[model samples]
Target: MKRFLTLLIAVVIALSAMSTFAENAKTLKIGTDAEPIGFDPHTTPAHASIRIMHQMYETLVELDDDLNVIPELAVSWEQPDDLTYIFKLREGVKFHSGRELKAADVKYSFERILNPDLGALGSTPSYAGNIDKVEVIDDYTVKITLSKITAPFLASMSSIYCSIVDSEAVEANGDLLRADGGTGPYTLGEWVPDNRVTVNRFEDYWLDGYNFENIEFYVISDSSARMSALRTGEVDIIIGDSAMLSIAEAAPNVDVHKIRTRDYITICLNLNMPEFSDVRVRQAISLALDRQEIIDLACDGQAEVSGFAPASMGHWAVDVNEHPLYKQDIEKAKELMKEAGFENGFSVTCTVGLNDHIRNSGTVIQQQLAQIGIDVTVQNKENAQYVDDWKNHDFEMMICQNGAGSDPNRAVAFFFGTGANANIAEYSNARVDELCELGAGTTDVDKRREYYTEAINIILDECPNVTFASPYNYYYASSSLEGYSPTLNRPLDVRNVTKE
Candidate 1:
């Protein structure tokens, strides 16, 4: 009896010690790609990097699990006119520096976003493009006046780029933002570029306390390196898709989480240019390769052949019947080429980033196009440089991927509208633009769907872009981890996450 009692006492002591240790733990080890260029929310625009910045800043509004806009910094908002929106800010919120968050700060935040000198306008054009001016009503109230009625205006603000920053912090930072100034759930604790970024939990965050004690982000771009880190217990989580599933499925101590993504890989053809102006040439380009095979080789059988934008995304994804671009017929492609007077295939340069997936897809696409008598010269460039070149219209053909949001209008307006940054294809269709406008303006969901469905049909018929496959996003976590909920539109919400 004494022996059993002693064993029970030992077990209790061990459990007590573990509970105490967990409460006092102050560091979490996370692995990611290279560190962001800067800590400034406006300057760090890369999707991976910006997600980290979002942890340092809070937005006025956020999307819930269902992608519905809910209160975050702003308690509520009202539209007084077609072009004016009034917002009632949350009271008593404080920045990390102990400054009160006010309406002036909100106004300054929008103004900073609109400032041409900030250089963020290019990446977050959607937010700035709609706003004509901002008016401060009081300490906790502000009104945003737009140049025109944009139906998706509030929805656009839910994006990461629209995160509100402390105006005072920006002025003090003067281009190089300090680590610990925002009012997010975590404050930047330490930063070692290309190595690691550490953030400590902010007890005074506007929201309830987050479950994490600390977050440590490590930069490891290689798939093998990340897998090794997870396996060896050097990191607690991996966010990217490369080699995530294989490692998680094989490892006893890791859990793999998958999110259905609207992200799709596209082959963008520059339609405005003379070389690609012919419809036959575009048809030939589409015919040259097997999209399913590319999905198999590039994504390791993890992706789905995208059929006219993802249906799960929202109303703007035109019904498959409305668009015929998803269908692959090599014979039809040949016939179109003949009709366009290109009896002999022409040579064109295909540009792609040197990232893992991009390179893999590019190589497969080159071979596929070659099979259809189209000579494709693949040019590899650094990811950042390639994005710049594509935006500047410097490439004949470019391979790119787009992470679509829950709202289909967000995707349609940014990629299909006139002067859209993603419209590198320079595709201009008056009828398509009209449909897009009608869809965006209507508040009725069914009516909006009808308009977008028509717009998608026009886009498919025009064939401005060729889609290969839609990739799924995968994350790997240590088995000891809990409360790790992954969202399709947002990055890992580390706020509620805990490590055992």
Candidate 2:
């Protein structure tokens, strides 16, 4: 009887200790501008969803904090020839769905993204569209062959677009947009649209150092409200702008961090629209708007007046502002408008995202373009509707940020490379396509620069889109949060982060 009583007491004490440990596990809450667009990395375009998906998915290769390619699922890879690469996976990596990750799953993921008829309409497909074949050599080995020799092939795999998923899970469910099939550190827990998204840590995650039990992204659209939440300790961090950086600087307990990014605030013109079809008409619109003034008024003077690529691209970046097309020329714009058969500028709607920067820029652009007799009506739709409209190419002109990277192909090719996956404008130019291909096929920096320069010059004259200001990815976090660092691409890496 005494032995039984002692055993019961011992079990009770162990249970109490376990309960306390579980309660002590960290839960990170972040205040974001918006909720995820969807959970699927291959089908996610906007920043809101990409950030969440990175936490929920794992690519074979991933970008480190320095934007360099580092092995994730793939321990190592070798290129036997210019066109073929063999990847070796680590042991015992498991997906959030069910079973362990295998080479077949990687093959399946590549095939799924490269499938033309799959009708997956996201921008991610382009990163893998060059893949000609994916063959599973064994349970832990896979070989991939590109259609052609490419300079950035290895770095391309580092993109979130190359995330690997469970083949069986995807086969059972057409897509994993709302399902869990990733082998990342975290898996989707619950999501309430336009409200909050919670992702719990994966117990079977192959890598170590993810100490947080779960991470929560609370959607707080209003910048001021997000600041308030940060102040009240409702959120550990917030995606903020230069304005919020000032606020964080003022508060003693808040920490301000900024990543010099290659992102650009641009106006996308749909070519299908008759008004924007004529190159002269597009050029006129581009010439009429003042990018510097827009940057000052809308971006709080926190952005750089740049070309298609941000200045951070260094030698590869184009300074379109140095050319006449980007200079504000009202008379030339009016003359071009008359030549395009619109003597009195036509009316068009400029769709803006649900952010103060975009809204202010759109409004300022509306006033700027009016100088050339163009009638601009600015419109702001709800989050879902706006993303839907942008995806469907339903807008005449949309004001948004163009996500660029350090790669030469990223700035000129991602959207403008003719038949590109993310070419929302449906624009095609044979010369530009040829130049982009030439740029990607070589490792010679000088040769690549010449090719990209020609392409950007043509794009500027053709005016498929107008680049205005280059903005930085600014973050505000509490002092208690440690090990959290943001990359230039704005993908969140919380695996090493801890909350005090």
Clashes, model 1: 1
* RMSD score of candidate 2 (Å): 4.8
lDDT of 2 by residue, 434-468 (tens): 98889888878899899988988888788899878
Per-residue lDDT tens digits for candidate 1, residues 186-231, read 8877878668777777777777747777788887878778878988
Off by over 4 Å in 1: 1-25, 33-40, 43-45, 116-128, 173-181, 189-191, 211-213, 319-323
**Candidate 2: segments with Cα more than 4 A from true spot:** 1-25, 121-126
What TM-score would every model get versus the actual structure? 0.87, 0.92
Winner by TM-score: 2
In terms of lDDT, which candidate is strongest? Answer: 2
lDDT of 2: 0.81
